[model samples]
Target: MIALLGCGVVLLSACGSMPVTGDIKAVDASQPGDSQVQVYAVAPRENATPDEVVDGFLESMTSDDPGFRTTRKYLTKEASRTWKPSAFTTVLSKAPNRSQRPVRDSDRSSTELTFTLTGDKVATVDAQNAYQPVAPTAFSRSLHLVRQNGSKEWRIDFVPDGLLLGQSDFKRLYRSVNKYYFATGPAADQSTLVADPVYVRNRTDPITGMDTVTQTVRSLVEGPTNWLRPVVDSRFPTGTVLRKGVTALAPDDRNVLKVPLNKKADGVGQRSCRMMASQVLYTVRDLTSARVEQVELQRSDGSSLCVLGSGQAEEFAPDGSSGAPDSQYFVDDEGHVQRIPGSNKGSGDPEPVAGPLGDGPVRMSTVGVARDEQLAAAVSQDSASLYVASVVSAGELPRPAVTSRAKKPEDRLSAPSWDGRGDLWVADRNPDDRRLLRLAGGTGEPSNVRVPDLGGARIEALRLSADGVRIALLLTEDGHTTLKIGRIERQGDPDTLQDVSVVELRKAAPQLADVTAMSWSGRSRLVVVGKEQGGVQQVRYVQVDGSAPASGVLPGANQVSSVAAADDEQLPLMADTEDDGIVKLSPGDNWQTVLKKGSSLVYPG
Candidate 1:
């Protein structure tokens, strides 16, 4: 087990002894940024033999090329023309090994050679950009090589359809890039663009960053990544192509990118044209060292159709496009929903909200705020029932949304979560009936959510993304817990209640043996509280792609009952530190007590 940082003692009074002071503080906010510059190795010597060819090919597969074009040189003419590296990509946890023998020694002029490859498959990415989880599996492959026609030099005849790379090489060779896709929301902001992240080669050429922008634009025009296709839509017309005969792309001196699309974009709507331009701007802005203030969409003749400036881009709330809220909402000492005004400014005083749930007779054990922040869903004190209430004075009294029929108090309901579309989601913990229910907004019928491959695991906690497309779940089976992410699949008509299903369930934090709680820190990052196998409990940040970064311990707190973060990345992370009350932590900051008297705290995303 790894030793935790910031060791200290924090004492807690009996649960009811904490007080609710009406005082709040102001907190300073900051943002974090990053960059990736890659250096690729030179290609193998031209006169290399079969064995040398195989070695060089495998090594070059990990290079930062827009395509596996560099690795194709090791193959024969016909084989190279038939090869498709992007059909699938296998990511290995450790480096792969190839057989020492690349040819049959007995027959010097043998036309065929084979190289055996082996590795532990960690994950696989299909052409559609879907990441499928695989167990720690041992797999082997055989590559066929042959001497081309009359040439003594051996070239690969047949190879796998995908690219293979070690974990270290993946980190060094590729960079995560965000392509914008529109989120479905209310009519007022229905087509709001949200970021869908995908990994692309860090650079086309190691020297200049020119190819990065071109590669990104090509991927965006290819349509939303496969995993995000169902939940989001793109504005680029189908079959849109760059200007004829243009092999590369770069912004002009004015830092304005003029993207020439094919005739497919001929008669597009003005709003959609602007949105497409925004998608391009957001995609290439960070990739270029030049200040990109705007992206212009044009016809083949170079006539400008629309232009989107950096100032006009509308990013998702979770992307920190919208500033953090002035305060965070939590339950007061009386179990009433209250706000800590100016939470980003270090304000800690409690202020009751102007709503029925604020000071009403109803008391909740946990609460979830809608993405709009006007309504809240809460669990009753006993946890047997779920309730929805207005957080504004213009609303009505709290009403029971769903109640469990379980006789055992322990088998009640978990906390509720609100998606970007305002639907409330919760799981019934009753062992007799493990059901994930969705309560539609404004009197819509509740429906069961189909969870794929749930097996014998019980749902301990679940949180939805602001885009309403994915869910983070903590499941327990056989005394062990696992954290998994699944894509939400909605079928049928929206007017009539439809069945909601979860497909492509993949492990998010495969290293964590026990996950007690989790919350989305961003569209692609989740802050999880759990313990690794044989490790002590701790809090850490994990990417949806299953990358865990270093994290500090919660000072003075031994155990955390729950964890939460605002959808706005600028806000700090708040958690109910078990016996230590409520504490908050900002990036590069230590955990500090924000409320010395509250439990089940949360900052709705």
Candidate 2:
């Protein structure tokens, strides 16, 4: 791989209006002894024993499965495509017993393949057949092991099921290997080896009344090559409309998004990623009455439990104790508010995390919504509290993951959204790692999918586009703003991240400051920004081909703080400011509000 170092000049390229690199460093591997699933490179000794690394990896795959969750980060395009056939599960399933695992056969050979590298032109592979003796079965097939980058780091993948029958391709791949390449038919097709679908929703078009639900989208992840590419299966109905629509009685929109969180037993819940299971998440309703009415519980079963938000305004005294604002959070099936206790905190407003936030730092954040029912919010800083709702870290975790992501306290939670069964996407930043984060997976222990890292800049505001594809983060460093845009998932090599781009606000909206919040008008090709300076709100857009400047800069938005837009083409920017009340920036550059105290607005579920 040393020969490829010259390619650094060819490879490429965050949001926070005034973006900065967080300096999230990779963990120091040399620090005496440390623990983390990571890749290491040691100087080759005079006669270092063969490709021991590959042998070790095969062993680790069975014994220590840590690499399963983060392998995509290091995969090349070809390898990632072959191994991660689908985008979601490349990081979704890690447990040996999950349905995604290959079914163990009684006659299968040992589940092991060791690689030995002797020099530039020669290498050897030893296989431990997986089929067991009881079911003794032997199969032969053609396989290829290709090197990625310049390293002897080889990947063994099948070349389409039976195409190998043609000797030409086989000769092209294995003609140089020792003897004839060792053969073992297909292990389970990786596609069938996915962790079963987590969340699914069944929605019907409101006007047409046609079903919009489709079969389950196994895990929120699929293979990197198949990203954003919809998969249609006959098992469930298939159709999509402008929106993800409401709950129904079918498998597509199975209706209940159950998330499995990423957890480690630290006595109290410490910082980690949260896996939002199958569920569709929606934003909070725009508030009209400013009188702080009450918080209530909305369950997946469609039941409502009123919360007495009065006396319990800011306390964390359990469910029925001290009448705290405990009900304002998300609740699990056991009726317990799933919280991490001491992990919540807020930015610049240090009132000691009053109430349910307790004494946590109050930088609590959220991911998306849960199956259209609850908002995912991290209620603590030291640990994560599900609040039945919402939504960081570093070598603190790994690379790609560290981008956009700041350190623990800074991984301030973002709202979480459940795709249906249990797929969740949480927003976080690690300035230290220069990466943004998307914490994906179940509630037990989440898989951290790193995005292009955004450093030093503080993410004053962020929001996922209603279309569910785009995400906007308003970044600020020393209170200055900059905007960064990139794909939602982290795929490919841990050292090689794809699709992370930054748009300088000064080049777009030069007058904006402390760009606190942002959201995508998904379809209209626009990004809505809420500027803190004089509450100046602006709507800007970039073309897939990179044309035109951010065109829709309104002259009067002195009070808007939050926004949400689905009909991005008709109305691009929605501003909720103290002075502007509610302003809608649309086709005619209009301005108006449908409600007040619009701290948040949504197309309610």
Worst 10 residues of 1 by lDDT: 26-35
lDDT by residue for model 2 over 337-401, one digit each (tens)? 22212122100111211223222223333323332323333333232333332221101111121
lDDT of 1 by residue, 191-301 (tens): 556667666665563322336677678778878876667767778888886766544567889888888887888778888898888888877777777878888998867
Which sections of candidate 2 miss by over 4 Å? 1-386, 389-411, 415-423, 428-444, 452-455, 465-470, 489-514, 530-551, 571-573, 580-589, 603-605
Best by TM-score: 1
Give the per-residue Cα lDDT of candidate 1 at 320.
Answer: 40
- lDDT for each candidate structure: 0.70, 0.28
